[model samples]
Target: MRFTLRQLEYFIAAGETGSITHASERINISQPSISTAISQLEQELDTQLFIRHHAQGLSLTPAGRIMLMEAKRLVEQAESLYAAASEASEEVRGQLNVGCLTTLAPMVLPELSISFMSAFPRASIRPHADHQEMLLNGLHRAMIDVAITYDLQIPADIEFTPLVDLPVHAIVGESHPLARHSAVTLSELAELPLILLDLPLSAEYFTALFMKEGLSPNIAFRFSQPDIIRTMVANGYGYSLANVTPRSDTALDGRKVVRVRLSGENRPMTIGFATLKQLKKSRLLAAFATHAKSFISDAYIPGMVAPAMGQKKR
Candidate 1:
Protein backbone atom coordinates (compact mmCIF):
# COMPACT_ATOMS: atom_id res chain seq x y z
CA MET A 1 0.00 0.00 0.00
CA ARG A 2 1.28 3.48 -0.83
CA PHE A 3 -0.36 5.10 2.25
CA THR A 4 1.06 4.63 5.75
CA LEU A 5 -1.07 3.31 8.64
CA ARG A 6 -0.82 6.68 10.40
CA GLN A 7 -2.29 8.32 7.31
CA LEU A 8 -5.10 5.78 7.22
CA GLU A 9 -5.78 6.41 10.92
CA TYR A 10 -6.08 10.13 10.29
CA PHE A 11 -8.36 9.48 7.33
CA ILE A 12 -10.55 7.20 9.42
CA ALA A 13 -10.80 9.75 12.23
CA ALA A 14 -11.62 12.55 9.80
CA GLY A 15 -14.19 10.43 7.97
CA GLU A 16 -15.88 9.41 11.22
CA THR A 17 -16.03 12.90 12.69
CA GLY A 18 -16.83 14.55 9.32
CA SER A 19 -14.58 17.47 10.28
CA ILE A 20 -10.82 17.82 10.23
CA THR A 21 -10.92 20.13 13.28
CA HIS A 22 -13.06 17.74 15.31
CA ALA A 23 -10.88 14.79 14.29
CA SER A 24 -7.78 16.67 15.35
CA GLU A 25 -9.31 17.38 18.76
CA ARG A 26 -10.43 13.75 19.16
CA ILE A 27 -6.94 12.35 18.41
CA ASN A 28 -5.04 15.28 20.00
CA ILE A 29 -3.28 16.27 16.77
CA SER A 30 -3.10 19.46 14.80
CA GLN A 31 -5.80 20.15 12.16
CA PRO A 32 -3.15 20.67 9.49
CA SER A 33 -1.65 17.26 10.23
CA ILE A 34 -5.03 15.51 9.90
CA SER A 35 -5.84 17.40 6.67
CA THR A 36 -2.44 16.59 5.19
CA ALA A 37 -2.71 12.89 6.10
CA ILE A 38 -6.22 12.58 4.62
CA SER A 39 -5.12 14.41 1.47
CA GLN A 40 -2.09 12.13 1.15
CA LEU A 41 -4.28 9.05 1.67
CA GLU A 42 -6.70 10.24 -1.07
CA GLN A 43 -3.82 10.82 -3.46
CA GLU A 44 -2.36 7.36 -2.81
CA LEU A 45 -5.79 5.76 -3.33
CA ASP A 46 -6.38 7.92 -6.48
CA THR A 47 -9.85 9.04 -5.34
CA GLN A 48 -11.53 11.99 -3.68
CA LEU A 49 -12.69 10.64 -0.35
CA PHE A 50 -14.43 13.69 1.09
CA ILE A 51 -16.70 16.53 -0.10
CA ARG A 52 -15.49 19.67 1.56
CA HIS A 53 -18.06 22.33 2.45
CA HIS A 54 -17.08 25.94 3.18
CA ALA A 55 -17.34 26.42 6.99
CA GLN A 56 -19.59 23.32 7.29
CA GLY A 57 -16.82 20.66 7.59
CA LEU A 58 -16.27 17.51 5.46
CA SER A 59 -18.64 14.79 4.30
CA LEU A 60 -17.71 11.26 3.27
CA THR A 61 -18.34 10.29 -0.36
CA PRO A 62 -19.72 6.80 -1.05
CA ALA A 63 -16.17 5.59 -1.65
CA GLY A 64 -14.98 7.19 1.57
CA ARG A 65 -17.71 5.39 3.57
CA ILE A 66 -16.64 2.01 2.17
CA MET A 67 -12.97 2.71 2.76
CA LEU A 68 -13.66 3.72 6.34
CA MET A 69 -14.93 0.24 7.18
CA GLU A 70 -11.87 -1.44 5.70
CA ALA A 71 -9.60 1.03 7.45
CA LYS A 72 -11.13 0.16 10.84
CA ARG A 73 -10.68 -3.56 10.19
CA LEU A 74 -7.06 -3.03 9.14
CA VAL A 75 -6.37 -1.02 12.28
CA GLU A 76 -7.84 -3.76 14.46
CA GLN A 77 -5.76 -6.38 12.67
CA ALA A 78 -2.62 -4.31 13.16
CA GLU A 79 -3.34 -4.01 16.88
CA SER A 80 -3.82 -7.77 17.05
CA LEU A 81 -0.46 -8.29 15.35
CA TYR A 82 1.18 -6.00 17.91
CA ALA A 83 -0.47 -7.92 20.72
CA ALA A 84 0.78 -11.23 19.34
CA ALA A 85 4.32 -9.91 19.08
CA SER A 86 4.20 -8.64 22.67
CA GLU A 87 2.94 -12.00 23.80
CA ALA A 88 5.73 -13.91 21.97
CA SER A 89 8.34 -11.61 23.44
CA GLU A 90 6.73 -11.91 26.93
CA GLU A 91 6.71 -8.16 27.27
CA VAL A 92 3.76 -6.35 28.90
CA ARG A 93 4.10 -3.10 26.95
CA GLY A 94 1.45 -1.11 25.07
CA GLN A 95 -1.35 1.39 25.47
CA LEU A 96 -4.19 -0.43 27.27
CA ASN A 97 -7.42 1.56 27.12
CA VAL A 98 -9.36 0.92 30.34
CA GLY A 99 -13.02 1.74 30.96
CA CYS A 100 -14.35 2.15 34.48
CA LEU A 101 -17.72 2.68 36.14
CA THR A 102 -18.14 6.41 36.86
CA THR A 103 -18.87 5.88 40.54
CA LEU A 104 -15.87 3.60 41.04
CA ALA A 105 -13.43 5.60 38.91
CA PRO A 106 -12.44 8.19 41.48
CA MET A 107 -11.72 5.62 44.15
CA VAL A 108 -10.29 2.65 42.24
CA LEU A 109 -8.43 3.89 39.15
CA PRO A 110 -5.78 6.28 40.51
CA GLU A 111 -4.21 3.80 42.93
CA LEU A 112 -4.57 0.72 40.73
CA SER A 113 -3.30 2.48 37.60
CA ILE A 114 -0.33 4.04 39.41
CA SER A 115 0.71 0.73 40.96
CA PHE A 116 0.31 -1.19 37.72
CA MET A 117 2.29 1.36 35.68
CA SER A 118 4.92 1.43 38.41
CA ALA A 119 5.27 -2.36 38.07
CA PHE A 120 5.42 -2.30 34.23
CA PRO A 121 7.20 0.89 33.25
CA ARG A 122 6.83 0.20 29.55
CA ALA A 123 3.05 -0.23 29.75
CA SER A 124 0.74 2.84 29.77
CA ILE A 125 -2.99 3.12 30.55
CA ARG A 126 -5.69 5.37 29.09
CA PRO A 127 -8.69 5.54 31.38
CA HIS A 128 -12.31 6.30 30.41
CA ALA A 129 -15.09 6.48 32.97
CA ASP A 130 -18.81 6.32 32.18
CA HIS A 131 -22.05 4.45 32.86
CA GLN A 132 -22.32 0.66 32.51
CA GLU A 133 -24.16 0.75 29.18
CA MET A 134 -21.58 3.12 27.68
CA LEU A 135 -18.75 0.97 29.00
CA LEU A 136 -20.28 -2.11 27.34
CA ASN A 137 -20.78 -0.15 24.13
CA GLY A 138 -17.13 0.95 24.23
CA LEU A 139 -16.07 -2.70 24.44
CA HIS A 140 -18.23 -3.63 21.44
CA ARG A 141 -16.89 -0.70 19.43
CA ALA A 142 -13.26 -1.67 20.26
CA MET A 143 -12.79 1.68 21.98
CA ILE A 144 -11.81 0.09 25.31
CA ASP A 145 -9.84 -3.06 26.08
CA VAL A 146 -11.37 -3.76 29.50
CA ALA A 147 -13.77 -2.30 32.04
CA ILE A 148 -13.88 -2.24 35.84
CA THR A 149 -17.58 -2.44 36.64
CA TYR A 150 -20.37 -4.33 38.41
CA ASP A 151 -21.81 -7.59 37.11
CA LEU A 152 -25.02 -5.95 35.90
CA GLN A 153 -26.86 -7.10 32.76
CA ILE A 154 -23.72 -8.49 31.14
CA PRO A 155 -24.33 -9.70 27.59
CA ALA A 156 -22.97 -13.05 26.35
CA ASP A 157 -20.26 -11.36 24.28
CA ILE A 158 -18.66 -9.93 27.41
CA GLU A 159 -16.84 -11.91 30.12
CA PHE A 160 -16.71 -10.89 33.79
CA THR A 161 -14.20 -11.98 36.40
CA PRO A 162 -15.38 -11.20 39.92
CA LEU A 163 -12.82 -9.84 42.36
CA VAL A 164 -14.98 -8.92 45.38
CA ASP A 165 -18.58 -8.57 46.57
CA LEU A 166 -19.70 -5.21 47.91
CA PRO A 167 -22.75 -5.52 50.13
CA VAL A 168 -25.37 -2.78 50.30
CA HIS A 169 -25.15 -0.25 53.13
CA ALA A 170 -27.46 2.53 54.30
CA ILE A 171 -25.83 5.94 54.47
CA VAL A 172 -27.35 8.34 56.99
CA GLY A 173 -26.39 11.63 58.53
CA GLU A 174 -24.64 11.36 61.92
CA SER A 175 -27.64 13.01 63.58
CA HIS A 176 -30.16 10.61 62.00
CA PRO A 177 -31.96 8.22 64.34
CA LEU A 178 -30.68 5.09 62.60
CA ALA A 179 -27.07 6.26 62.53
CA ARG A 180 -26.33 4.67 65.91
CA HIS A 181 -27.65 1.27 64.89
CA SER A 182 -25.20 -1.50 64.03
CA ALA A 183 -27.41 -2.66 61.17
CA VAL A 184 -30.73 -1.59 59.65
CA THR A 185 -33.27 -3.48 57.58
CA LEU A 186 -34.85 -2.27 54.36
CA SER A 187 -38.26 -2.36 56.07
CA GLU A 188 -37.05 0.25 58.56
CA LEU A 189 -35.74 2.40 55.69
CA ALA A 190 -38.62 1.97 53.23
CA GLU A 191 -40.78 4.58 54.92
CA LEU A 192 -38.02 7.14 55.39
CA PRO A 193 -37.25 9.72 52.72
CA LEU A 194 -34.61 8.26 50.42
CA ILE A 195 -31.98 9.96 48.27
CA LEU A 196 -31.36 7.63 45.35
CA LEU A 197 -28.32 7.46 43.07
CA ASP A 198 -30.32 7.21 39.87
CA LEU A 199 -27.85 6.21 37.18
CA PRO A 200 -29.28 3.90 34.48
CA LEU A 201 -29.00 0.25 35.58
CA SER A 202 -27.73 1.28 38.99
CA ALA A 203 -31.11 2.79 39.90
CA GLU A 204 -32.83 -0.46 39.04
CA TYR A 205 -30.45 -2.41 41.28
CA PHE A 206 -31.13 -0.20 44.28
CA THR A 207 -34.90 -0.06 43.84
CA ALA A 208 -35.08 -3.81 43.27
CA LEU A 209 -33.87 -4.37 46.78
CA PHE A 210 -37.04 -2.73 48.05
CA MET A 211 -39.28 -4.42 45.49
CA LYS A 212 -37.97 -7.91 46.37
CA GLU A 213 -39.18 -7.50 49.93
CA GLY A 214 -42.64 -6.13 49.01
CA LEU A 215 -41.61 -2.58 49.88
CA SER A 216 -41.31 0.68 47.99
CA PRO A 217 -38.74 3.31 48.87
CA ASN A 218 -39.94 6.81 49.56
CA ILE A 219 -37.62 8.36 47.01
CA ALA A 220 -37.69 11.98 48.02
CA PHE A 221 -34.79 12.94 45.79
CA ARG A 222 -32.72 11.42 42.99
CA PHE A 223 -29.28 12.33 41.63
CA SER A 224 -27.00 10.64 39.16
CA GLN A 225 -23.73 11.32 40.96
CA PRO A 226 -22.84 9.37 44.11
CA ASP A 227 -21.03 12.28 45.72
CA ILE A 228 -24.10 14.46 45.34
CA ILE A 229 -26.23 11.83 47.00
CA ARG A 230 -23.69 11.63 49.83
CA THR A 231 -23.73 15.38 50.31
CA MET A 232 -27.53 15.45 50.33
CA VAL A 233 -27.70 12.59 52.78
CA ALA A 234 -25.19 14.34 55.05
CA ASN A 235 -27.31 17.49 54.95
CA GLY A 236 -30.26 15.35 56.13
CA TYR A 237 -32.23 15.61 52.88
CA GLY A 238 -32.70 11.84 53.01
CA TYR A 239 -30.89 8.59 53.71
CA SER A 240 -29.38 6.71 50.78
CA LEU A 241 -28.14 3.22 49.91
CA ALA A 242 -24.76 2.24 48.49
CA ASN A 243 -22.51 -0.79 48.11
CA VAL A 244 -19.08 0.86 47.99
CA THR A 245 -18.27 2.24 51.40
CA PRO A 246 -15.67 4.99 51.27
CA ARG A 247 -13.04 5.00 54.01
CA SER A 248 -14.00 8.48 55.07
CA ASP A 249 -17.45 8.69 56.67
CA THR A 250 -17.90 12.27 55.55
CA ALA A 251 -19.37 14.09 52.60
CA LEU A 252 -17.37 16.23 50.16
CA ASP A 253 -18.28 19.29 52.25
CA GLY A 254 -16.85 17.73 55.44
CA ARG A 255 -20.14 16.66 57.03
CA LYS A 256 -20.18 13.32 58.84
CA VAL A 257 -22.23 10.40 57.48
CA VAL A 258 -22.52 6.82 58.72
CA ARG A 259 -22.68 3.63 56.66
CA VAL A 260 -24.83 0.97 58.35
CA ARG A 261 -24.93 -2.56 57.01
CA LEU A 262 -28.24 -3.53 55.42
CA SER A 263 -29.78 -6.44 57.23
CA GLY A 264 -31.62 -9.47 55.72
CA GLU A 265 -30.92 -11.17 52.40
CA ASN A 266 -29.76 -8.29 50.24
CA ARG A 267 -27.87 -8.93 47.04
CA PRO A 268 -24.31 -7.60 46.99
CA MET A 269 -22.82 -6.07 43.82
CA THR A 270 -19.79 -8.01 42.49
CA ILE A 271 -16.94 -5.77 41.40
CA GLY A 272 -14.86 -7.18 38.54
CA PHE A 273 -13.23 -6.77 35.13
CA ALA A 274 -15.20 -7.00 31.88
CA THR A 275 -13.62 -7.77 28.54
CA LEU A 276 -14.81 -8.76 25.04
CA LYS A 277 -15.19 -12.55 24.95
CA GLN A 278 -14.12 -12.97 21.32
CA LEU A 279 -11.05 -10.71 21.47
CA LYS A 280 -7.73 -12.34 22.23
CA LYS A 281 -6.29 -11.15 25.52
CA SER A 282 -3.14 -9.12 24.87
CA ARG A 283 -0.16 -9.67 27.19
CA LEU A 284 -0.57 -6.17 28.60
CA LEU A 285 -4.28 -6.80 29.25
CA ALA A 286 -3.47 -10.14 30.91
CA ALA A 287 -0.91 -8.47 33.15
CA PHE A 288 -3.40 -5.77 34.18
CA ALA A 289 -6.00 -8.42 34.97
CA THR A 290 -3.51 -10.24 37.18
CA HIS A 291 -2.62 -7.00 38.91
CA ALA A 292 -6.31 -6.23 39.53
CA LYS A 293 -6.92 -9.63 41.11
CA SER A 294 -4.07 -9.09 43.54
CA PHE A 295 -4.98 -5.46 44.25
CA ILE A 296 -8.71 -5.89 44.89
CA SER A 297 -10.24 -8.65 46.98
CA ASP A 298 -12.76 -9.31 49.75
CA ALA A 299 -10.12 -8.46 52.32
CA TYR A 300 -8.98 -5.23 50.69
CA ILE A 301 -10.29 -2.77 48.11
CA PRO A 302 -8.67 0.46 47.02
CA GLY A 303 -10.23 3.70 48.30
CA MET A 304 -13.03 1.87 50.09
CA VAL A 305 -13.41 0.16 53.44
CA ALA A 306 -13.05 -3.63 53.33
CA PRO A 307 -16.30 -5.58 53.45
CA ALA A 308 -17.49 -6.15 56.99
CA MET A 309 -15.98 -9.20 58.68
CA GLY A 310 -18.12 -12.35 58.47
CA GLN A 311 -20.28 -10.81 55.76
CA LYS A 312 -21.47 -13.77 53.73
CA LYS A 313 -21.14 -13.45 49.96
CA ARG A 314 -24.54 -13.96 48.41
Candidate 2:
Protein backbone atom coordinates (compact mmCIF):
# COMPACT_ATOMS: atom_id res chain seq x y z
CA MET A 1 0.00 0.00 0.00
CA ARG A 2 1.20 3.51 -0.73
CA PHE A 3 1.78 5.34 2.54
CA THR A 4 1.57 9.10 2.89
CA LEU A 5 4.62 10.93 4.34
CA ARG A 6 2.47 12.80 6.85
CA GLN A 7 1.35 9.58 8.53
CA LEU A 8 4.95 8.34 8.79
CA GLU A 9 6.15 11.64 10.29
CA TYR A 10 3.44 11.66 12.99
CA PHE A 11 4.33 8.07 13.98
CA ILE A 12 8.08 8.89 14.25
CA ALA A 13 7.67 12.05 16.28
CA ALA A 14 5.46 10.27 18.86
CA GLY A 15 7.94 7.36 19.11
CA GLU A 16 11.06 9.56 19.47
CA THR A 17 9.72 11.97 22.12
CA GLY A 18 8.17 8.97 24.00
CA SER A 19 5.04 11.04 24.65
CA ILE A 20 2.09 11.66 22.40
CA THR A 21 1.58 14.96 24.25
CA HIS A 22 5.12 16.18 23.48
CA ALA A 23 4.94 14.93 19.84
CA SER A 24 1.66 16.83 19.36
CA GLU A 25 3.19 19.98 20.94
CA ARG A 26 6.27 19.76 18.66
CA ILE A 27 4.14 19.01 15.62
CA ASN A 28 1.61 21.74 16.55
CA ILE A 29 -1.17 19.11 16.42
CA SER A 30 -3.58 18.25 19.20
CA GLN A 31 -2.66 15.18 21.32
CA PRO A 32 -5.77 13.29 20.12
CA SER A 33 -4.89 13.89 16.48
CA ILE A 34 -1.33 12.54 17.02
CA SER A 35 -2.80 9.50 18.82
CA THR A 36 -5.31 8.92 16.02
CA ALA A 37 -2.59 9.18 13.33
CA ILE A 38 -0.41 6.59 15.12
CA SER A 39 -3.39 4.29 15.68
CA GLN A 40 -4.44 4.57 12.02
CA LEU A 41 -0.83 3.82 10.88
CA GLU A 42 -0.77 0.67 13.09
CA GLN A 43 -4.19 -0.36 11.80
CA GLU A 44 -3.05 0.09 8.18
CA LEU A 45 0.04 -2.04 8.75
CA ASP A 46 -1.89 -4.45 11.01
CA THR A 47 0.93 -4.10 13.54
CA GLN A 48 1.27 -2.98 17.15
CA LEU A 49 3.73 -0.04 17.28
CA PHE A 50 3.43 1.52 20.75
CA ILE A 51 3.79 -0.11 24.21
CA ARG A 52 1.92 2.21 26.58
CA HIS A 53 1.36 2.50 30.35
CA HIS A 54 -1.07 4.71 32.24
CA ALA A 55 1.60 6.32 34.57
CA GLN A 56 4.69 6.13 32.24
CA GLY A 57 5.43 7.46 28.73
CA LEU A 58 5.13 5.29 25.59
CA SER A 59 7.90 3.12 24.19
CA LEU A 60 8.31 1.52 20.70
CA THR A 61 7.43 -2.11 20.15
CA PRO A 62 9.46 -4.24 17.64
CA ALA A 63 7.06 -3.25 14.90
CA GLY A 64 7.45 0.40 15.91
CA ARG A 65 11.24 0.13 15.47
CA ILE A 66 10.76 -1.09 11.89
CA MET A 67 8.25 1.68 11.18
CA LEU A 68 10.63 4.20 12.73
CA MET A 69 13.33 3.32 10.18
CA GLU A 70 10.89 3.80 7.31
CA ALA A 71 9.68 7.07 8.88
CA LYS A 72 13.22 8.48 9.05
CA ARG A 73 13.81 7.54 5.40
CA LEU A 74 10.56 9.21 4.32
CA VAL A 75 11.51 12.38 6.22
CA GLU A 76 14.93 12.42 4.54
CA GLN A 77 13.32 11.96 1.12
CA ALA A 78 10.96 14.86 1.79
CA GLU A 79 13.87 17.06 2.83
CA SER A 80 15.70 16.15 -0.38
CA LEU A 81 12.66 17.18 -2.37
CA TYR A 82 12.60 20.53 -0.60
CA ALA A 83 16.29 21.07 -1.26
CA ALA A 84 15.90 20.28 -4.99
CA ALA A 85 12.94 22.60 -5.26
CA SER A 86 14.83 25.41 -3.56
CA GLU A 87 17.84 24.98 -5.85
CA ALA A 88 15.61 24.92 -8.93
CA SER A 89 14.06 28.24 -7.94
CA GLU A 90 17.37 30.12 -7.89
CA GLU A 91 18.39 31.32 -11.36
CA VAL A 92 22.15 31.16 -12.13
CA ARG A 93 22.55 29.26 -8.86
CA GLY A 94 21.99 25.65 -9.91
CA GLN A 95 24.52 23.10 -11.13
CA LEU A 96 26.31 23.83 -14.42
CA ASN A 97 27.84 20.63 -15.72
CA VAL A 98 30.49 21.12 -18.41
CA GLY A 99 32.81 18.89 -20.41
CA CYS A 100 36.30 19.58 -21.74
CA LEU A 101 38.48 17.54 -24.01
CA THR A 102 41.77 16.29 -22.59
CA THR A 103 43.87 18.81 -24.56
CA LEU A 104 42.07 22.10 -23.95
CA ALA A 105 41.13 21.65 -20.28
CA PRO A 106 44.73 21.74 -19.08
CA MET A 107 45.77 24.93 -20.88
CA VAL A 108 43.30 27.75 -20.25
CA LEU A 109 40.45 26.12 -18.26
CA PRO A 110 41.76 27.04 -14.81
CA GLU A 111 41.82 30.76 -15.63
CA LEU A 112 38.53 30.53 -17.51
CA SER A 113 36.84 28.97 -14.50
CA ILE A 114 38.14 31.71 -12.22
CA SER A 115 36.64 34.34 -14.51
CA PHE A 116 33.36 32.43 -14.68
CA MET A 117 33.19 32.29 -10.91
CA SER A 118 33.77 36.02 -10.64
CA ALA A 119 30.96 36.61 -13.13
CA PHE A 120 28.46 33.95 -11.97
CA PRO A 121 29.14 33.62 -8.28
CA ARG A 122 26.20 31.39 -7.48
CA ALA A 123 26.42 28.57 -10.04
CA SER A 124 28.54 25.50 -9.37
CA ILE A 125 30.53 24.46 -12.45
CA ARG A 126 31.21 20.76 -12.40
CA PRO A 127 33.86 19.87 -14.98
CA HIS A 128 34.10 16.47 -16.64
CA ALA A 129 37.16 15.57 -18.71
CA ASP A 130 36.74 13.17 -21.58
CA HIS A 131 37.55 12.42 -25.21
CA GLN A 132 35.71 14.16 -28.06
CA GLU A 133 33.03 11.52 -28.65
CA MET A 134 32.17 11.25 -24.96
CA LEU A 135 31.90 15.03 -24.71
CA LEU A 136 29.58 15.13 -27.71
CA ASN A 137 27.43 12.40 -26.17
CA GLY A 138 27.14 14.34 -22.93
CA LEU A 139 25.88 17.33 -24.90
CA HIS A 140 23.20 15.22 -26.61
CA ARG A 141 21.97 13.80 -23.29
CA ALA A 142 21.83 17.26 -21.73
CA MET A 143 24.36 16.10 -19.21
CA ILE A 144 26.54 19.13 -19.94
CA ASP A 145 25.63 22.71 -20.76
CA VAL A 146 28.71 23.34 -22.92
CA ALA A 147 31.89 21.64 -23.94
CA ILE A 148 35.37 23.00 -24.52
CA THR A 149 36.99 20.90 -27.21
CA TYR A 150 39.08 20.88 -30.38
CA ASP A 151 37.35 22.19 -33.49
CA LEU A 152 36.04 19.34 -35.63
CA GLN A 153 33.45 19.39 -38.39
CA ILE A 154 30.80 17.93 -36.04
CA PRO A 155 27.21 17.14 -37.00
CA ALA A 156 24.80 19.97 -37.84
CA ASP A 157 22.76 19.05 -34.74
CA ILE A 158 25.81 20.01 -32.71
CA GLU A 159 26.83 23.69 -32.69
CA PHE A 160 30.50 24.68 -32.84
CA THR A 161 32.13 28.10 -32.53
CA PRO A 162 35.79 28.58 -33.46
CA LEU A 163 36.91 30.79 -30.62
CA VAL A 164 40.57 30.88 -31.63
CA ASP A 165 43.43 28.95 -33.12
CA LEU A 166 46.15 28.52 -30.48
CA PRO A 167 49.76 29.13 -31.50
CA VAL A 168 51.64 25.90 -31.03
CA HIS A 169 55.34 25.63 -30.15
CA ALA A 170 57.82 22.81 -30.33
CA ILE A 171 59.33 22.08 -26.92
CA VAL A 172 62.17 19.89 -25.71
CA GLY A 173 64.25 19.42 -22.59
CA GLU A 174 66.84 22.12 -21.92
CA SER A 175 69.53 19.47 -22.13
CA HIS A 176 68.40 18.52 -25.64
CA PRO A 177 70.71 19.63 -28.44
CA LEU A 178 67.92 21.50 -30.28
CA ALA A 179 66.90 23.39 -27.11
CA ARG A 180 69.90 25.69 -27.65
CA HIS A 181 68.51 26.81 -30.99
CA SER A 182 65.79 29.42 -31.56
CA ALA A 183 64.03 27.23 -34.14
CA VAL A 184 64.26 23.83 -35.77
CA THR A 185 63.22 22.45 -39.14
CA LEU A 186 60.83 19.50 -39.53
CA SER A 187 63.62 17.40 -41.07
CA GLU A 188 65.90 17.87 -38.04
CA LEU A 189 63.26 16.43 -35.61
CA ALA A 190 62.36 13.52 -37.92
CA GLU A 191 65.29 11.39 -36.81
CA LEU A 192 64.63 12.03 -33.11
CA PRO A 193 62.27 9.88 -30.99
CA LEU A 194 59.45 12.23 -29.97
CA ILE A 195 56.76 12.24 -27.29
CA LEU A 196 53.36 13.03 -28.80
CA LEU A 197 50.20 13.98 -26.92
CA ASP A 198 48.11 10.90 -27.78
CA LEU A 199 45.14 13.04 -28.84
CA PRO A 200 43.62 12.75 -32.32
CA LEU A 201 43.75 16.48 -33.03
CA SER A 202 47.35 16.75 -31.92
CA ALA A 203 48.30 13.56 -33.71
CA GLU A 204 46.58 14.65 -36.93
CA TYR A 205 47.92 18.21 -36.79
CA PHE A 206 51.58 17.35 -36.03
CA THR A 207 51.84 14.21 -38.16
CA ALA A 208 50.57 16.24 -41.13
CA LEU A 209 53.47 18.62 -40.58
CA PHE A 210 55.95 15.77 -40.99
CA MET A 211 54.00 14.41 -43.96
CA LYS A 212 54.09 17.84 -45.65
CA GLU A 213 57.88 17.80 -45.29
CA GLY A 214 57.84 14.21 -46.71
CA LEU A 215 59.29 12.96 -43.40
CA SER A 216 57.75 10.56 -40.89
CA PRO A 217 57.84 11.21 -37.11
CA ASN A 218 59.61 8.71 -34.89
CA ILE A 219 56.79 8.74 -32.35
CA ALA A 220 58.33 6.92 -29.40
CA PHE A 221 55.69 7.63 -26.76
CA ARG A 222 52.06 8.75 -26.80
CA PHE A 223 50.55 10.36 -23.70
CA SER A 224 47.40 12.45 -23.13
CA GLN A 225 48.60 14.70 -20.36
CA PRO A 226 51.05 17.50 -21.18
CA ASP A 227 52.49 17.35 -17.66
CA ILE A 228 53.29 13.67 -18.05
CA ILE A 229 54.81 14.33 -21.46
CA ARG A 230 56.86 17.17 -19.98
CA THR A 231 58.05 14.93 -17.19
CA MET A 232 59.07 12.30 -19.70
CA VAL A 233 60.94 14.96 -21.70
CA ALA A 234 62.50 16.53 -18.60
CA ASN A 235 63.89 13.24 -17.36
CA GLY A 236 65.44 12.69 -20.80
CA TYR A 237 63.08 9.84 -21.54
CA GLY A 238 62.04 11.52 -24.84
CA TYR A 239 61.26 14.82 -26.58
CA SER A 240 57.74 16.29 -27.12
CA LEU A 241 56.25 18.07 -30.17
CA ALA A 242 53.08 20.03 -29.42
CA ASN A 243 51.31 23.12 -30.77
CA VAL A 244 50.84 24.81 -27.39
CA THR A 245 53.82 24.76 -25.01
CA PRO A 246 53.57 24.64 -21.26
CA ARG A 247 52.61 28.23 -20.36
CA SER A 248 51.51 27.73 -16.75
CA ASP A 249 53.41 27.03 -13.53
CA THR A 250 52.53 23.35 -13.86
CA ALA A 251 53.87 23.35 -17.39
CA LEU A 252 57.50 23.06 -18.51
CA ASP A 253 60.12 22.80 -15.83
CA GLY A 254 62.21 25.88 -16.67
CA ARG A 255 65.34 24.17 -15.48
CA LYS A 256 64.91 21.18 -17.76
CA VAL A 257 62.45 22.12 -20.52
CA VAL A 258 62.53 24.88 -23.13
CA ARG A 259 60.20 25.72 -26.05
CA VAL A 260 61.44 26.67 -29.52
CA ARG A 261 59.75 27.67 -32.75
CA LEU A 262 59.18 25.32 -35.67
CA SER A 263 59.85 27.61 -38.60
CA GLY A 264 57.77 26.04 -41.39
CA GLU A 265 55.55 23.33 -39.93
CA ASN A 266 54.42 24.60 -36.51
CA ARG A 267 50.77 23.49 -36.36
CA PRO A 268 48.15 25.33 -34.30
CA MET A 269 45.21 23.37 -32.87
CA THR A 270 41.74 24.92 -33.22
CA ILE A 271 40.03 24.97 -29.78
CA GLY A 272 36.48 26.09 -29.09
CA PHE A 273 33.17 25.40 -27.30
CA ALA A 274 30.56 22.88 -28.46
CA THR A 275 26.91 22.39 -27.52
CA LEU A 276 23.65 21.11 -29.01
CA LYS A 277 22.43 23.46 -31.73
CA GLN A 278 18.76 23.41 -30.68
CA LEU A 279 19.51 24.02 -27.03
CA LYS A 280 18.99 27.74 -26.56
CA LYS A 281 22.26 28.95 -25.16
CA SER A 282 21.69 30.08 -21.63
CA ARG A 283 23.01 33.49 -20.62
CA LEU A 284 25.46 31.76 -18.34
CA LEU A 285 26.63 29.37 -21.06
CA ALA A 286 27.00 32.19 -23.57
CA ALA A 287 28.95 34.25 -21.07
CA PHE A 288 31.23 31.33 -20.20
CA ALA A 289 31.86 30.41 -23.86
CA THR A 290 32.69 34.04 -24.71
CA HIS A 291 35.04 34.48 -21.77
CA ALA A 292 36.68 31.09 -22.25
CA LYS A 293 37.40 31.83 -25.91
CA SER A 294 38.77 35.29 -25.13
CA PHE A 295 40.94 33.94 -22.33
CA ILE A 296 42.54 31.36 -24.62
CA SER A 297 43.11 33.99 -27.33
CA ASP A 298 44.70 36.47 -24.94
CA ALA A 299 47.07 33.88 -23.50
CA TYR A 300 47.84 31.50 -26.37
CA ILE A 301 46.54 32.67 -29.77
CA PRO A 302 49.64 34.50 -30.97
CA GLY A 303 50.10 35.34 -34.70
CA MET A 304 46.59 34.00 -35.29
CA VAL A 305 43.27 35.69 -36.12
CA ALA A 306 39.76 34.85 -34.90
CA PRO A 307 37.43 34.23 -37.83
CA ALA A 308 33.99 35.88 -38.09
CA MET A 309 30.87 34.09 -36.86
CA GLY A 310 29.79 31.23 -39.20
CA GLN A 311 33.27 31.31 -40.78
CA LYS A 312 35.66 28.39 -40.35
CA LYS A 313 39.30 28.95 -39.36
CA ARG A 314 41.97 28.71 -42.08
| Each prediction's whole-model lDDT (CA) | 0.90, 0.71
The regions of model 1 sitting more than 4 angstroms off are 1-78, 308-314
TM-score of decoy 2: 0.62
Model 2 misplacement above 4 A: 1-91, 248-255, 265-267, 299-314
| Candidate 1 per-residue C-alpha lDDT over 38-58 given as tens digits, one digit per residue, 9 for 90 to 100 | 888888899899999999999
Worst 10 residues of 2 by lDDT: 305-314
Report the C-alpha displacement of residue 184, candidate 1, in angstroms: 1.1
